[model samples]
Target: MKHLNTFNNTILYDFMELFHSLPYTFLGMEKSKDAFESAKVVLLPVPYDGTQYPYKGAANGARAIIEASRHIETFDDELNLELEDLGIYTLDELEISLESALETIKRVQEAVEEILDNKKMPIILGGEHSISLGAVRAINAKMENVSVLQLDAHADLRNEFKGCKYAHTCVMRRINEISHYVGVGIRSMSKEEKEFIEENELDIYGTNFNSNEILEKLKDKVYITIDLDVFDPSIIPSVGNPEPQGLFWIEILELLKKIAQEKEIIGFDIVELSPNSNKISDIYAAKLICKILSFSFFSKF
Candidate 1:
């Protein structure tokens, strides 16, 4: 691994403490991307999970994930590179009051638009899958040449979930309206989603297909989003929407690496972690987010 060490070879716990003390700050320097107004990568945290049925902790998912990121080393052994040096800006959590899901999406859309207008790559920390509707819509409006990669266990292609068209169950269906999306790790689906999948011929699937194969089939640029429920409920049970079976960390990393190698990821997000005092789950979410940024932005830069 090509670790360009900037910090001293300090203790891991000390490093975690440093990262935890200021969860969102870059390098313990009270650093803000405000200085680099033209930063390429932007991290947006949306901690609202207003409509999550039976699960309430996803509302705190963004904060918990950010907190856990402190212990993450800058270097990624798999990618053989260091992160953080690439100038990925972490935005303070967006103000999402007790608003309707539709309203929250509008708010998220505006926030993502501001970041994208500056030509920055947005890595959104989602409150729910619905938040993606706004971000994807804005990105679609700005750039017509991009594709969406929806990662989750559920198809999320239903026309509506219960009475809400904007439920997590329909998030990808919403994405279908804005962009050509390819879904991976979809093991669950509503009837409407099944109908839509069959009618529209969506690439929603259950197995870990070859990333290179998928990449070759896709266009050159992509927007990657992950709803943590994509992993099996066994390993990552702390999600708002838990599923029966799913992908492992290495499997996910491999696909992400291939995407980074083969395409330009215009934007991305990791959402739906619903931690319940399980420190490992929160830490896992945080470290995974850090690892993703490392492979997708930091390591490459």
Candidate 2:
């Protein structure tokens, strides 16, 4: 019995080694021929988190999500499509800038601009929410009448936080300067953000917001920024901030499906996943990215 157990363990080890030896792309898929030229979607992993806060591991979130994605099945039963055929190209992780958050954001903006120039949809995997401003900046510069759809627990409307104007907490404020934005799944914010929302009559919605109302506020072109904390801690507890009573899986998916069916998603980012002992959170984040892509590209309903 002991020898049999040893053999089983050896086979398992060999299987894992073979799997790891494959090309390290999202979903462990083979590299596409002329990936950059033929691909309709380009994924940019931005591993950066410069926020001065206790939750410091978000810098590793992008890699974690990619690793978790390898275990997911490539076929989506709901969409009835194989994602691998979509020519989704995963670019090398962006070189992070240590100078400052603003500098990092600038680097992100440049990378996203290049992706846009290629005429492919950009899906940014975030190290933190602040990285989203870079993509938003790039999209706003090229597209007109663009509206940002923010899905997060916090309003992130602060002008500045911890002396950093470009910190993750203040990302939406900076975005407001470039294009109109609607905030949804928001359950927390500062008095300043509340006052600002009221003053501007911004389309900021709580957890119970109607999807139709949120869609009406958006223009034809929409850039979505999803902070993982917008999900209930019960579903995804590994984030920089875990607020209570957040949106559940099916609820958020329904809303995303509606948005994908209606709005023209110019670009999107998923951020603020600080990986921890709970491996489920990492897998959940990866699946969320896949579902979003599937909805945007292949959803019939």
Q: Estimate every model's Cα lDDT from 0 to 1.
A: 0.76, 0.88
lDDT of 1 by residue, 117-201 (tens): 8888787886778888889988977886788888888887777766888876678878888789888888887677688799888
Q: What's the true lDDT of residue 44 in model 2?
A: 93
Rate residue 236 of model 2 by lDDT. Answer: 96
Q: Give the TM-score of candidate 1.
A: 0.86
Instruction: Give the range of the ten consecutive residues with the poorest summed lDDT in model 1.
Output: 1-10
**Each prediction's TM-score versus the true structure:** 0.86, 0.91
Which regions of candidate 1 deviate over 4 angstroms? 1-29, 33-38, 298-300
RMSD of each: 8.0, 6.0
Off by over 4 Å in 2: 1-20, 299-301
Candidate 2 structure quality by residue, lDDT tens digits, 29-74: 6676686678788889989987837778888888898889988898
